[model samples]
Target: MRINKFIANSGFTSRRKADDLIIQGRVKINGQTIYEPGIQVVDGDKVEVEGKLLTIEKKFYIKLYKPVGFITSNFDPYNELDLNDLLDIDKRFFAAGRLDKDSEGLLIITNDGEFTNNLIHPKFKLDKEYIVKIDRKLRASQEKKFEKGLDIGNGEKTSDAKLEYLGNNTYSVIIHQGFNRQIRRMFKVLGARVIELKRIRIGKIFLGDLKEKEYKYFSKDELKFVDEMIR
Candidate 1:
């Protein structure tokens, strides 16, 4: 198998991240540091990432209701709260998709690197649904502009989005792109500030009754749609 895939299969991280490690000379095969991501590995060849031996770990798929004030990462430089603290599982896992520190809602946690790549890759075009509360009511013209797309600075125009106006300055927004602070940036261009943002769904997976700081393993039925999509 390719070096990146081999590392990913070992449950260290996603293939993309593994490639980064290879390029950074952090990956070694039999004590030889390698800078090539495409190197092949065969049986009996030992691999080490960051000087730690790699081993295929049991895979886990979990859905978590991430609350505000927690970063969706394994480490934070400023010593802020991390989502991993809420999970009691002993296995190392990472978020498939991320929510900003101020945002809250559904998040997928897993140790399967291939699965993470497939779920977040733009080519799949998975629908991500969010509930956004802005500082003020949305105007008709602003809504039209938002639906058509806007230039959220740096000459980057957002794609067309679907929006449903719920009562009290809240709206249901659906987007496929996973740009950084995308929903918030889209609203900012229309003279609105997102007061609260919560993701409620990703494709067919719903947050449902999952409360903040709570998580559960994906049931067989829930995995059905996800598996079919990634495949």
Candidate 2:
């Protein structure tokens, strides 16, 4: 099979990212550096990524309610906080997307690299819902701007969004894009200060009574719904 396809099949990265690994000289085939993207590999050929043997076994998929103050990374060099410390596992897993340190809500940690790509890529157009509380009252004009997409710091405008006011400084907003600190930035652009932000849903999966700092695996039906949505 082609080198890129082989790397992708190993579940190390997507086909596009696999090409990057080849160009960076991080992938080797048969004990030789294989920088050519179109190189072929056969059975009995040894494949290594960044000097570690690549294996396609023991994939894991899990969901957790990420609490405030905990970083989303598997390890944090500065704060010495690691998400894995909360889980009982020896396998390596990565967060599919991200929730900022100050934000709290549903987060998926998994070893299934392919599922991570499909879930995060914009082509899937899956919706992520959040309930946020702001310090200032939302004005009517600001509400229209959110529906039409606002200029939130980036040179690009936010994608169309669904916003509903829940009264008493609370509102529910659903967005398709997962830009960095996107929900918080949008509110800031409207001259509002966010007091709290929590993601409540990802696609058909809901936070579902999971308390802060709590965790649970995706149910069979929830996993099936996600698979069908992306497929």
Candidate 3:
């Protein structure tokens, strides 16, 4: 198999990350350091990564309460706190989508790339709900803009959104689009900067009472619900 695909099938990391490992000379096949990303590997070839055996189990799915200022990556060049450090699991995982470092809340970590694609794909229409705190109060017209959907300014209009005021500069909203910095950009377009943004829900799964930086495994029923959501 292709080196990247082999690494991913071993559940070590994503195919892209596996390519990085190969390029960095950290991956070896049958005791030979393979720096070429295109090198293939067979079942009988012994593999080692960073002097550790390159063997891994199946995929995993987990939910974590991501605090602010941490990146959703296995490695960070800027010396930032990676999402892996927040979890104590033995298996390697990657974020499904991503939250900006300044934003916080529920983040899904999994080893299944296909499943992640389905969850984050725009065509699936999965709803991502957030509890947002804005810097200023929203006028009635601003609420109308949110309800009717606003021009995202890239010539693309955002989908219709649902908003509910939670009093004291806070409100909850559900949006189908997952564009980069979407919620922030939406509020920015409405002249209200987001003071705080927390993704409280994905699909029908809620964060419930999970505390800061805490994590949990999805129940069988919860997984079923998530699977059905993408269908």
Candidate 4:
């Protein structure tokens, strides 16, 4: 199998990211640096990425309602807040995508590296929907701008977003791209401050009734839907 797929089977991260490691000279095969993502790997051949040995195993997937103030990273060197502390599960899992520290809502947690790739890969065009509440009511012109995408400053512009007025200070925004602090930054660009941001959906999976910090494993039906979508 290809080295990128090999690292992904180890459950470290997505195959896409593994390719990045190879390009960065951070992946090795039998103690030799390997920059080719397609390099073949056979049984008995040793592989390491960033100095850690690799292996494949059963994958675990979870859907968690990530509450504000908790980060998505495995560990945080500052603030001392870890997402794992909110769950009782023993296995190591990673957030498929991310939400900022101040944002809250549905977060995909999993040991399936390939699923991570599927969720965030640009070709998939999966819509991540968020209900955002700003300090005041949003304007129609703002809606048009969101539809066309926004210039969030510093040469970073948002991707095309679908918008729906949910009345008052809230609106539903669906975006395909996952730029850093995308929603918040776009709102800031529009001269408004977002009071709250909650992700309600990712593809066909809804955050659904899960309270803050609550989590559940993906059901067979849910898994099937996701697999079909990714496939």
Q: How high is each candidate's TM-score?
A: 0.80, 0.81, 0.74, 0.81
Descending-lDDT candidate ranking = 1, 4, 2, 3
lDDT of 3 by residue, 9-79 (tens): 56666667778888999998888899887887777888787777766467667888999988878788877
Q: Stretches of candidate 4 above 4 Å error?
A: 1-7, 12-53
lDDT against the true structure, per candidate, is: 0.89, 0.83, 0.82, 0.86
Selected candidate, larger TM-score, 1 vs 3? 1
Off by over 4 Å in 1: 1-7, 12-53
Residue 68 lDDT (model 4): 89
User: How would you encode candidate 1's per-residue C-alpha lDDT over 32-113 as one tens digit per residue?
Assistant: 9999999999989999999899977777788999999999998778888997578887777789988999999999998887
On a 0 to 100 scale, what is the lDDT of residue 86 in model 4? 80
Q: Once model 1 is optimally superposed onto the true structure by TM-score, how far is the C-alpha of residue 177 displaced, in angstroms?
A: 0.8
Report the C-alpha displacement of residue 103, candidate 3, in angstroms. 0.8
In angstroms, the error of model 4 at 172 is 0.8
Task: Estimate candidate 2's alpha-carbon lDDT, on a 0 to 1 scale.
Answer: 0.83
Better of 2 and 4 by TM-score: 2
Best by TM-score: 2
Task: Determine the backbone clash count of candidate 1.
Answer: 0
Task: State the lDDT of candidate 2 residue by residue for 1-231, as single tens digits.
Answer: 888867766778877788999999999987899788899988888889899887556555677898888888887778655586667768777888889989999898777666788788898888999999999778999998987898877586798999999999999999989889998889888899899999988888788998977788878887896567434
